[model samples]
Every structure is written in C-alpha cells, then in structure tokens.
Target: MPNIVTLAEAKLFIRVLDDDEDTTIETMIAAATDAVCDVAQAWDGTGEPPARLKLAILSRVAIMFDTRNSLEPGIGEDRLLLPLRTVEL
Candidate 1:
C-alpha cells in the first residue's frame, strides 16, 4: 500500500540512473512500475488490495511526506511527485 523503496534499492536505483543517464524510456517506466509493484506486493502479499485501501495508503504517504518535510502544505496530486524529493529512501 505504502510506496517505498528499500534504502539499498534506492541507492542502487539512483546510482544506475545517474551513471547511465541515457537509460531508455521503457526501462525507466519499468523501473517505476516495479517500484509500485514492490509496494503492492508487500502490502497485500497476493499483490493486490481493494482499490480503496490502495488509495488510502497512498494518501497517507502523501500526508506524511508533506508533514515530515515541510514541502508546501495541503494535498494535491502533485504532492505525490514531491515525495520523491523529500523521501530519504
């Protein structure tokens, strides 16, 4: 439910992106999808949860990110993107 990357995975992922710089769009897209899938799998184990539960989890992450980082107050779809900047892992 919560979108998260392991600290090691985040470090490795960023390193690869930084080093490659020219990773294909498809590869980037796959990596994004894999990140989400990793969260979903951990949340439900079966790899799926009810849509409402998924949304609630996502909402919690957004709220936590904004509160924890002091990235502009309030919720907006764009806040989801901001978490990438605020999150440590």
Candidate 2:
C-alpha cells in the first residue's frame, strides 16, 4: 500500500459521501492499486509513484463503481501508465 492512494482520498475523489459503501470502496481501492502496479510493471517505484498513476487509479475505481460489474470500455489509460511501464525486450 506504499504507493496506493488512501481510502479517504479515494472516497473524496469518487465522492462516496458516506460510510455505507466504505467496504466496497476499500475493495475497489485495493484492486485498483494492484491493477495499476501490474500495468506499470513495477511496484517498486522509488519515492512517490507519481500523480498520474494515482489519478489513473482513481479513474479506474470510478469506472468500477459506475459499471457495478466491470470496468467500462475505452478507459484510454495508456498515457497514465505507459510512461511508467518498464519495457522488456
């Protein structure tokens, strides 16, 4: 959870506005964190993981929340994650 955004921050970003959905939001945050790390291809980002990555997580969580069952198509997140991606030959 070192580079992941906190529950409070995610709630605010997604405008949860209440504790009723706290558990669900927490789940989304955890999953989103892992997903972002996978996309970045490295969880060992030095210092902070960068704002774009954090925002990408928030956007993903929002998509998860809105879709209810799965993330929406056309998330267009390559820009947020590609720069941080570690290329492998």
Candidate 3:
C-alpha cells in the first residue's frame, strides 16, 4: 500500500538522518497514518489524502518517534484533526 507520508518525509520530520531505523520509522509511519485517518474519518485511501490529514499523520509520527520510550504522555494532533472528523453513522 502507498503511504500518504513517504518514508523520506517522515525521516526528515523526525530528524532521523540515518537508515538504521528505517524499519522502525516505517512501522511508525504506517501506524500513525492509520491512527490519524481513523481519527479524521478520512480513510478514503483513493490517493493522497487531504493536506490536513497528511500534516496530522506527520505530527503523529514525530510525536511517536520522539516519545518512543517515555513514561509521560506526549502531545497529539487529535485536536487539530477533530474539526475534520465525521460521524461514522
């Protein structure tokens, strides 16, 4: 499956310059994309989602990558995406 945010984009966002964590980052990207899309109710998956959705996914990936092993909760993009969410009825 094609990702809205590419691996290169995510690595740059997370300041990961090396390929040592490509697998890990890729996993996070996929997970973040899914979580963001589900939250935004923007799972059309036809092609690149909206820009807002992409931003949300990128933010999510950054947060997850930065807070990988932290005990405290990290910030989220939920509020930013709440306005775009749709009722699932």
Candidate 4:
C-alpha cells in the first residue's frame, strides 16, 4: 500500500521547497506510514487514516528526512502513543 499521507502533504508539513529530494521524501513517507500503522494498529477500523495518525506519519517522515545523514532517526514516543477512548456499553 502507498503512504496514507500524500507527497504534497508531507512536503508542506516539512516545509520542503524543490523536488530534488522527492524520491527520498517518498521513501520516508512509506516507511513512516508503515511504522505509524504498525504502532497504532491503524487498520483495525478506519475509512481514511485519522488526523492524529497522519500527523504522526508526517512528523516521522520529517524526522527521517532531517536526520538522513546523521545517527538513527529518533521519533518521539508521544508520536506513537494512541489516544485511549473508552467504550460505553
């Protein structure tokens, strides 16, 4: 599956300018989306990805891009934390 977030959306989130790094950005988007989906168990019940998941994916992608040449990318724990919604039965 392709990334939940679009290339344009990822670019906007990371404030990217030209398309020079588009391939790298696209790769990051796919990886980030996969990570978020895995952590969030996002496909359990969904139409489109929720806003929070999209934000998490975007943030992760930005982190990966910014730290491409450095040490391992460190996405914050908060980004992977899902909100706990209680069910009223």
RMSD of 4: 4.5
lDDT of 4 at 4: 77
**Considering every candidate listed, which one attains the maximal TM-score?**
2
Top model number, lDDT = 2
For residues 1-89, could you state the per-residue lDDT of candidate 2 as single tens digits? 57478888988988888899989998888888888878787547668778888988888888888888876522677788888788888
lDDT of 1 by residue, 34-56 (tens): 44443333344344444433333
- The TM-scores, one per candidate, come to 0.28, 0.87, 0.80, 0.74
Itemize residue pairs with steric clashes in candidate 4: none
Query: Scored by CA lDDT, what does every candidate get?
Result: 0.38, 0.80, 0.76, 0.72
Candidate 3 lDDT over 38-84, as tens digits, reads: 67764567865777777887887887888887423236566667776
CA shift of 34, model 2, Å: 0.7
Candidate 4, residues 2-89, lDDT tens digits: the string is 4579999999999998999999998898887776666676355456667777787788887888877643434563544455222346
> Where does the lowest 10-residue lDDT sum fall in candidate 1?
78-87
lDDT of 4: 0.72
* Superior by lDDT: candidate 1 or candidate 4: 4
- Each prediction's total of clashing residue pairs, residues at least 3 apart in sequence or on different chains, is 0, 0, 0, 0
Give candidate 3 misplaced runs (Cα > 4 Å): 70-76
Per-residue error at 89 for model 3, in Å? 5.4
